[model samples]
Each structure stands twice: as C-alpha cells, then as structure tokens.
Target: MSKFIIITGGVVSSLGKGISGASIGKLLQLNGLKVNMIKCDPYINVDPGTMSPYQHGEVFVTTDGAEADLDLGHYERFLDVNMTRANTNTAGSIYQTVIDKERRGEYLGATVQVIPHITNEIKRRFTAFENEVDVSIIEIGGTVGDIESLPFLEAARQLRLEKGPKNVICVHVTLVPYIAVAQELKTKPTQHSVNKLREVGIEPSMLICRTEKPLSLHLREKISLFCSVPTQAVIECADAKSIYHVPENFYKQKVDEQIIDLLGLTPKQKVDPKWFEFFDKAMTPSKSVKIAVAGKYSELQDAYKSISEALRHAGMNNDAKVEIVFVNTEKDNVEEKLKTADGILIPGGFGGRGVDGKIATIKYAREHKIPFLGICLGMQCTVIEAARNLCGLHDANSTEFDPTTKDPVVDLTPQQKNVVYKGGTMRLGNYTADLEEGSLARKLYGKDQIVERHRHRYEFNPAYVKQLRDTGLKVSGWHEGVLPEIVERTDHPYFIAVQFHPEFGSRPLRPHPLFDGLIKAGLKRKENK
Candidate 1:
C-alpha cells in the first residue's frame, strides 16, 4: 500500500499550500522515494479548460490531455514528474461523473446523495493510482472553511481514517503574519486555522507556517500548544528569492524526518543539499539580463508564473539574473511602451480581445530587429501578422476568429481526429514536432526531433507556406507531415514562434531550450543597446 500525505489549508487562501505540498513531494523524491502529486479543486467547472486566465491563472495540461488546475503545473515543475488526467479531480467533474452514471441507469433507482455517491467518486479518484507510486501528495484546493471545499475535505478525512493513521498524514499550511509595529510573529491566526481543521475531524499532523520573518521559539511553541502538533513539525517557510530554494529549506527544517516518523516508513535515501547550491548561485549571480514579456495578462503576477519560472530556470542555467519587464501589449501606445525592452516575448492565450494588439506587438518586434519569442496563440498571431504585412496577404487571419475566411493564414488542423469539441478538444499535453535541419530551432534545441507541451487548436495553414517563405518567413517546425508549428522571420534578428508551450516543462533546475535561447537573445540585445 502507498503512504499518503494530505496537505490542507486554513485561515485564508493563497497561503502556498500547493507549494508546500509540492515541496514535500520534491523532498520525498530526493530521498529516492517515487512520488506522485494530485490536486482536488472545488470549482464547479469540469476542469480549468473553459475558465479564463484572469480567473484561474494558467490551465496546466497533462500528458493525457487533462486540463487541470494551475497547481498541477507547480507539481510537475517541482517534482519533474509527468502527471496524467487521473491526478486531478474537481467537485464539478466528480458530480458530473456521478450524474452521468445516474442518467445511464447505472445507479439503479437509488436516490443519490452527496455523501455516498459524490464522496465515493472522490475516494475512487484519490485511490485510482494508489498502487502505482510509493507516495501520493494530495492538495485540497481552497481554504478549510470554504463551503465549496467541504465535500472534498470530508472525503479526504474519511480516506485518512480508512487508510489508518500510519498510512495517512495531514499537513496544514497556515499564515504567520508579522506585525511590523509589534516586532513579533503572531500565532493566533494559526490557532484559529487549526481549530477550524479540528472541528472537521481532521487534525493536522504537521503545520507549515508561511511568513515573511522566521518563526521564533516562543511563537512556535505557542502554535504547537494550540494546534496540537509538535514544535519540530511546525515548519517555518519564509519567503525566498527563488521557489527552488524551498526543498532545501524545508529539508533543513526536518520536514522530511517528521513525515517519515508520521508515516512509519523507512527512510530510503539521504537528501543531498549540494544540488541546490547551483540554484543559489544562480539566484545571486553577477550577470543580469532584462527580458520584456508582451502579454495580455500582465496585471496579475500569477498570469505568467510558469513563463516567468521558465525564464528564471534558463537564467540559472546560464548563471545570469533575469529581470522581467511585464509589458501590457494590449495598451493603445504599445510601440512607445515596448521601445526600451531588450527582448520581446509573447506568451500563450485565448479569445480575440487583445489579438490585434498582440499582432501589432509582433509586427513591431519583427520590424525593429528585436529578438522575439512567441508561444501558442502568440505563434499563430505572428504568422498572421507576417502574412499580412511582409507577404502582402491583407486578408491574413486565424480561423479561430474568422473560420469562414477564404484565405486563412491560420486554421484548425484538418488531419486532427478524435478531437470532440472546444472545451477539451484542442491538441494538448505533450506532442512531438520535427524540426528542420540547419534551422534556428534545430540549432538551439541541438536535436532534429523534440517533444513539448501544447495547448492550442489553431495552427499555421500550409497552403500559404510558399507565399510566406517567399516573403521571408520560414516554416521551421512542423507536426506529422504537413502542419506548420513554428515560424521564423528569416530577415529579422532571432524572431521565432512555436506552437507548443515550453514553459510548462521548464524547471528551476532544468530550463527549457526555447527560454534559454530567448534569454541569450535578450542578453545580446542588452549589450547592443
């Protein structure tokens, strides 16, 4: 049987419960324990697929085409593990499954209730991968007192009881706010948070406190006294310059030791603290580069969390510091706004609101000899802009917005089969793309064939390939035998657009090649400036 670590949050939201869970999973992996992470979201959406980026940050896609909560992205980047659709479950999805079964007459004339039917589905999803891995780190979305999250919390509570105390453990992440005037770390918030958890019959075996300042011995003892956890297990998670430092920091706090003791499992391997030394060096490195992200969702920091982390990883690899300038390309005066940036980056997105603005940003990058990197929708827009301005194809547009176009520069893949509808139908997750030899992408990746995560449906139409190439646009990457997946401006300085989201696979320790190349271009641009 697999040991389970259930991570819950209380007091309020945005307490880094997901990060704490991911940190624990990473520590377990360092101990040579095969680990898998799962997230239970309380939202009513079947998944985050149809949700807006403004609402839920980025929708993380899995290998099996599961559009999961953004925390799954954190799980994948932290542990360097490939998760499947089975790893993410939401209340909407669970209830939907149960309702579908009932409609099919599978439940057999019984009045369905949330307790036995809904909670059963939740348990089934949780244990679906029980025998597949050594440890499963499950994170409950939302706070302890949320009305929507009550069913998930109840289901997890029952699972812990059924799985036995030795097999299951709960870690509650709470905030420890520091009052600048008082010059002390407050502990009442944690006490109330733990009291809330206990009221639900789920006493946390450990408390991970997130705070700006380090927890004092007095504060730790106070929390332990009220929360009912040992002082040693009341781990302090101070804000670090980089998230990668979390694993080493938590390990130093004896978090892994506590987990081992609680689960009654033999320690598999010793964690090497030296692995994070390189990351530390990267964080405090001497060299620095500025990369401008011309994205639609720049107002919210979480909007580009994966993309920012990916760039940080690349900077770490190059032993440089990446300074991100969040440029809102949707602004009216975008040209003046992006004038001083070292390099231009257009990330993935949906909808048609800021598309013309994104295309304008792409045109500016191409015309001004700036190094440009485009992802997903950014790639399609680059092709559309290039076709219209450079190739003189005035009618250039994506089928996503103008599906009835007579001369579509971007259109849905005709050869793509088994795609049902718009909600989850896009070619998602990990897909292989063949790069042309002697091209910029091939040289940067150092490989002819590469696989990356994709989250878009519209692609560059091959019908305009000859026209685009004749006008200085190179179709450098393709899928199967036909569809154009990457387009590079032949006449410009390092302008490239890729259909896949390389940010999803990037880690602090392992940077993606595309981001590495973009950072290098940014550094070169800074020197030129």
Candidate 2:
C-alpha cells in the first residue's frame, strides 16, 4: 500500500514550500522507500507552457513530454528521479477533465459540482502512481486561504478518510518571520495560518516553520501549543547557506523518523549520508570560473532556474565555484558586459527581442576564442552569425526575426509550418541525435548517441548547413534527415552549441556531460589567463 504526504504553504507566498517538499522527498527516498512527487497548482491555465517566464519561471519538461511547473525540477534533482506528466496537476486540468467527462455523458446526466467532481479529479493526481511507489509527496501551490487552492485542499482533506489516517501525512509549511526591532520571532502568523487550514478540515500533522534564525525550544513549544502539534513536530527550518543541504538539515530533526512513524513504514535501509557529503563538497571548492549567460529574461533569476542549477551541478563536478553573470542583451551593452567572461552562453528564448545583441555576443565569443555555448534559439543565432559573417551572407536571418529575409538561415520545420496553437505546440520532450566521432559533443558525452529535451519552434535551415560547415563550423550532432542538433567551431577552443536543452537532464550528483564540459572549459580558460 502507498502512503501520501500533503504539503501546503501558509501566511505568505514564496515561502520555499518547494524546497521543503523536495527535502522531505529526498529523506524518504534515502530511507529505502520508493518515493514520488506531485505538484498541484491552482491556476486556470492548462499548464505554464504558455505563461511568460517572468510570470511563472521556466516550464520544466518531463521525459514523457509533459510541461510542468519549475518545482518539479527540484523534486527530480533532489530525488534523482525523472518525473512524468502524471506527477503534475492544475485546477485548469482538473476542471477541464471534469468538463470533458460531462460533455461525453460520462457523468450520467448528473449536475456536476466542485465537491466530488473537481476534487475527485484532483485526488486522481495524488493516487496516480500509488501502487508504483511507497509514498508520494504532493505540494499544493498558492497560499492557505486563497480561493484558487480550495478544491485541492478539500481533496487533500478527504484523502485521510479514503486512505485511512495512517496512510496520509499532512505537512504544512508556514512562515516565522523575525523582527529585529522586537528582538523576537513572531508566531501569530503561523498560528493564524494553521487556523485557516483547520477551517478547511485538514489539521496539519507537522509544522515546518520557515525561520531566518534557529528557533529556540521555547519558541517551538509556543508554536506547538498554538498550532496543535507536538513540540517535536514543530520542525524549525532555519535558512540554509545552500538549498542542497536542506535534506541534511531536516534529518537532524528526525523528520524522516516522524514521517515513517506516522505512515507506519518499516525501514527499507539505513538513511544514506551521501547528501551530507554532497553538501560538503559543494560548500568547499578548489577554484572558481565565471560564465556569462545572455538572454532577454535575465533580470529574474528564476526565469532560467534550471540553467543556473545545472551550472552549479557542473561546478560541483569540477570542484570549482561557478559565478553566473547574467548579461541582459535587451538593455545592457552586449560587448562591454561580456568582455571579462571566461565563457559565453546563449540560452533559449522566443521572439526577436534581443537578436542583434545575441548575435554580437556570439561574434565576440567566436572571434575572441572564448568557450561558448548556445541552445535552441542560441544555436539558430550561431547559424545566422556564421552565415552572415563567415560566409558573407549579409542578408542571413531567421524567419522568426525577419519573415521576408532573403537568406532564411533559420525557419520552421515542415510539421510546424501550419501549426495554430502557441502553448505545448513546439518540438518538445526527448529527441535523439547521433554524435560525430571525435567531435566535441561525442567526446563530452562519451557516446555516439544522446537524448535531450527541446522547446522551440524555429530550426536551423538545413540548406545553410553546408554553407556554414564549409566556413569551419562543424555539425557535430545530427538527427533524422541530417537535421543538426549540435554545432561547434573547430577553430575555437571548447565552443559548442545545441538545439536541445541539456540543463533539464543535468543533476547535482551526476552533472550532464555538456554542462560539466562547459565548466571544465571555463576552468581551463581561467588557468590559461
């Protein structure tokens, strides 16, 4: 039988519920339980695929091709597990499912309402992989009292009844802000937050209080009295120097012991201390490297969450601290900002917001022999840059930027030519590409074949492949019909670009080969300097 863990936030937003949930997931996985994670969002949109990066951060694509919330990335990296579309659920998806069932007369002519109809669909996401795993950690997005998450909360409340109290664990994460002037940590907000959740018919089994400083036993006791939890159940989660150390932090509090006790589980094995080792190595590095990331949405770090985390993973593998400098091509001086960069990266993005700046950055990196990496649109920019500058095709441009360009160096594929939808309509999920022997990509991945995630519409024009290759540009990796997946400059040191997003596959313990190689190249540049 599978047990369920419900995680919800209270008092405020951006309270790090995602990290808390991920830490718990890791603890259970380390304790020899087969663990899974699910994210329940309270938005009306089908997914975050169509939403702007500024609005919802980057959309995480599962191996199964489901575009999910960014928190799923945390779960995957923490547990070292690949999530699927089944691990995600949203209000829009739940309602849409119910409506579709009603339209098909599956409801048997009964008047549909939010109670069992919508809540049942929500619960379906919880029990999705029940038989496959020992436990599933379900995180409900939005605040406690928000109208958007009511149906999710209601469904979670009823899960206890259906699964029996022993099969379910309700964990509520709440804020415990400290007032410098008052010289005390406030517990009122947490108490009121618990009260609000209690009104929804779910009493949190544990309180993971987010605090800046360590919570004294007196403070924990106060929260326990007010929140109706045991003093030991009030887990004081102080801010950590790094998010990776969170699992270790909770392990010290015996959080895993409490969880297994509540759910009545036998230990599959002793909890591994590898997370502590991982945290130790991350905190102490032998050297450092600076990598410049050029993109339009550079202002918000969350916009490129996976890319940054992937860089950190690479940094850990190389025993070097990776300093990420975001060069916003839209407003910053492209050349001036990248003058001191050891490496330059052009991440994925849509529209023509900063094409000229990105082109300039690529030209500078190529001419200066700096290690450079381009992805998706970035790879297209490489084609455009090589076409115009190397091949002297001044009119070279992507159709996405110039619809009537004389030389369409980048354009839509045949299958996407007449596509109408914007959301979830791109060439997404996993695609395979065979690497050329002795090529940079082949050497880095240590294999001829590789699979990576993609989320873009425009593709490098195959017609321009010969022209660019003739100009010393290498087509290192290719998909079907000789379509390019990875490209590089033979003349430069460690310059590689790909049409796929390798960051999605990168992990902390085992970094993706491309990213790890990028950091290694950056380190070499630092040494040569």
Please provide TM-scores, in order, for all candidate models, with all chains considered together: 0.96, 0.99
Which stretches in model 2 have alpha-carbon errors above 4 Å? none
Where does model 1 exceed 4 Å of error? 180-183, 402-406, 413-421
Q: What shift in Å separates residue 72 of candidate 2 from its native position after superposition?
A: 0.7
Query: Which candidate number has the best lDDT?
Result: 2
Reference-based TM-score, model 1? 0.96
lDDT of each: 0.85, 0.91
Span of 10 residues, lowest total lDDT, candidate 2: 474-483
- The 10 consecutive residues of candidate 1 with the worst lDDT sum are 413-422
